[model samples]
Target: MYQAKIMALLFVAGDQGIKEKDLADLLEIDRAALRQNVEQLKIKLINDEESGIMLSQYNSTYKLITKSEYSELLTKYFKTGLGTKLSQAALEVLSIVAYRQPITRIEVDEIRGVQSSGSINTLLARKLIKENGKKDVIGHPNLYVVTDEFFDYFGIKNIEELPKIEKFEDYKEE
Candidate 1:
């Protein structure tokens, strides 16, 4: 039960990842106990091949990621009638990422004036956006960008096909 809770927390952490110390602090557990639980969770994720998700460790941070083998199926599922749709918040976050790609979550939050963690998670799960890499800033925050799936969904050959921001100026009231 405790391990499952820890795993849930990690899953919510998403591509930004969570540091070991931060996880320990969040769980109110000692470092040794946290390590043991993380190891157990890793083994459990590895054994649950049907889950399509896995635990990943990068520079002492842990994140939940989709397995490579499931990529084709995921794409097909999205392409087909999966009946999935993005919420308004998700669309807002996607637009920000599409326009200001390689941007950090903090920057997105600053722009939106609210925490967008859940919406970002949704975008990632739908493969509309992905973590390009960590920014070279303090804490090395993850940089996000639109994925190929994003282009496919929007019927665009490239980001260049997206409408320019200046085009919206006509809609602005005097």
Candidate 2:
């Protein structure tokens, strides 16, 4: 009962996603009840082999997103031109997120010495990066981190597998 309603609300909420609090309020249920329903829904979706969509939780927000297995088909159907390759700026942002995970957008911008919102959005659309949590600060900005897709894309088992970064002085013209 609640599961179906929650799914409908998530579908309608779309990419913006809905916070657990909001879902609870809308469903007129307590947090415990909502959690139980959400958990059951997650299990059902995961076990449903025919289901292309799954429940994705990011920073307390829940969203209905297509499973990674359908990425190729979705890319072809949407023809978004994302299949070619990532742009240079996007790659840079990805690298920054990969190395400094749980970093905020403002921090990334400061490191890059420019605004990185666009690049961050591109990486997010590609599912290579995702919002991990809110930074403990004034504005509570979202912290970014590389997703599992990132690991698979790079063909590495873990972040430790990435090559070590050498100091700039190592390659200085002498």
Best candidate according to lDDT: 2
Per-residue accuracy of model 2 over 54-161 as CA lDDT, tens digit each: 998898889998989999899797696666488777788889899888899999999899678868887888799999999999999999999999999899989999
Query: Residue 12: error of model 2 in Å?
Result: 34
Model 1: per-residue Cα lDDT over 1-174, one tens digit each: 668877788876655678889898988999899888888888888899677787788888888888889889888987887848777788999999999998999999999997788789888888999999999988999999999999999999998899998998789676
Question: RMSD for each model, in Å, please?
Answer: 7.2, 12.7
C-alpha TM-scores of all predictions: 0.53, 0.52
**How many angstroms is residue 3 displaced in model 2 relative to the true structure, after the best TM-score fit?**
52
Model 1 TM-score, all chains together: 0.53
Candidate 1: residue 86 Cα off by (Å): 0.9
On TM-score, the candidate that comes out on top is: 1
Q: How accurate is candidate 1 locally (lDDT)?
A: 0.87
In model 1, the Cα lDDT at residue 81 comes to 71
